[model samples]
Target: MRRRARELAMRALFAHTQGGVDLEEALRHALEEMGGEDDPYGDPLDEEGVAFARRLLFGYKAHQEEVDRVLKETVEGWDFGQMSKTDLTVLRLAAYEMLHEPTPFAPLIEVAVKIAKRYGGEHSGAFVNGVLGRLFRRIQEGEVKAAPKED
Candidate 1:
């Protein structure tokens, strides 16, 4: 369920950032593309999955500046313009979860890498893993502080 939610959230973020769609519209389109409840050919998300996806979407939006900043700082050589949209979206979602969610960093990074591999370019998984590993180490070393959880 969490994986599905992450996938949905990534797609929505990608649409919003790359396709220039608004957040709600991007989410609605992602849900429909991923197989809405009414789509017989698609794998529909459960209620919990949808809810979690919404949390990620809104949470990321709420902290988009910090997330992007962290990503920019952590990425060694690549500029945001040079990064693939899919990879950037996965990183943004992962960074948001890392900052706000209670989930451990390993699982979050693992999920992000998996999603990157599925949706990104050939080297995306390694790229995401490298960047996220650096980010996690920075967090652990007190170079980055996790934000307070929002209500």
Candidate 2:
């Protein structure tokens, strides 16, 4: 269920990136296309799942500039624009969750790599793993700081 939510959020982000729609609108449209409030377990519009997706989308968008900066600094020798859209989305999603969502480092990084392999191109899994591993290393080394926990 959680994985479904993440995938949905990524799809919405991809839609926003590729379709040029506002992020909220893109998420709405994606859920609607997935069957709205009706079909739950049978469709992608899982109730709890959408809530998690909404959280991810909002968090990702709210800190997009900083997140992009982090990605820019983390990934060496690759222009952000040069990234494949799928890979970029995966990285952004993973990066945001890694920093904010309180999921553990190993599971988070592994999940991101799996998603990249599922949705991204040939090298995306390895690429995402490398980039995320770098970020995790920084976190371990106290170079990349996490925001203070609230409540």
Candidate 3:
């Protein structure tokens, strides 16, 4: 159920990125498309899951410039523009979750890796893992600074 929610969120993000839809609007639209209020399992699209997705989308949207800057700095010679839309979306979502939110890292990274493997090409999982691993190390090493300056 949680996995399905993430996949739905990713799909919505991809559609938004590819189609230029507003993020919240896109999410609401995604909720609708995914059966919206009728979300049989309870909690109206699983409040926790949809909220998680919304949090991811908002964080990524808010910090996209910084995120892209990090990606540019980290991925040598690989222009962000050159990345596949799906790969880029996955990377952004994973990086945001891993770096910004209070969620545990390993499982989120694992989800991203698995999603990449399932949705992207042969090299996508390795590619996402390598990039996310770099991001994780940067955070652990105090290289990638957090917002609001955690004490």
Model 2, span 52-128: residue lDDT tens: 89999999989899888999999988987899999999899988987887777777788788879988999999999
In model 1, pairs of residues that clash are none
Error of 3 at 53 (Å): 0.9
Worst 10 residues of 1 by lDDT: 35-44
Better of 1 and 3 by lDDT: 1
Per-residue lDDT of candidate 3, residues 28-133 (tens digit): 7877767545554333467887877777787788888888777767665567788777888898887766667766777878888888887798998988888888
Best by TM-score: 1
lDDT of 3: 0.76
lDDT of the candidates, in the order given: 0.89, 0.84, 0.76
Model 1 agreement with the true structure over 19-131: per-residue lDDT tens digits = 89999999999887887665444667899999999999999999999999989999999999998888989999999999888777878889899989988999999999999
> If scored against the real structure, what TM-score would every candidate get?
0.90, 0.86, 0.81
TM-score between model 2 and native = 0.86
The true-versus-predicted C-alpha distance at residue 53 of model 1, in Å, is 0.8
- In Å, residue 17's CA in model 3 sits off its true spot by 1.3
Off by over 4 Å in 1: 36-42, 147-151
Q: Itemize residue pairs with steric clashes in candidate 2.
A: none
Q: By lDDT, who's the top model here?
A: 1
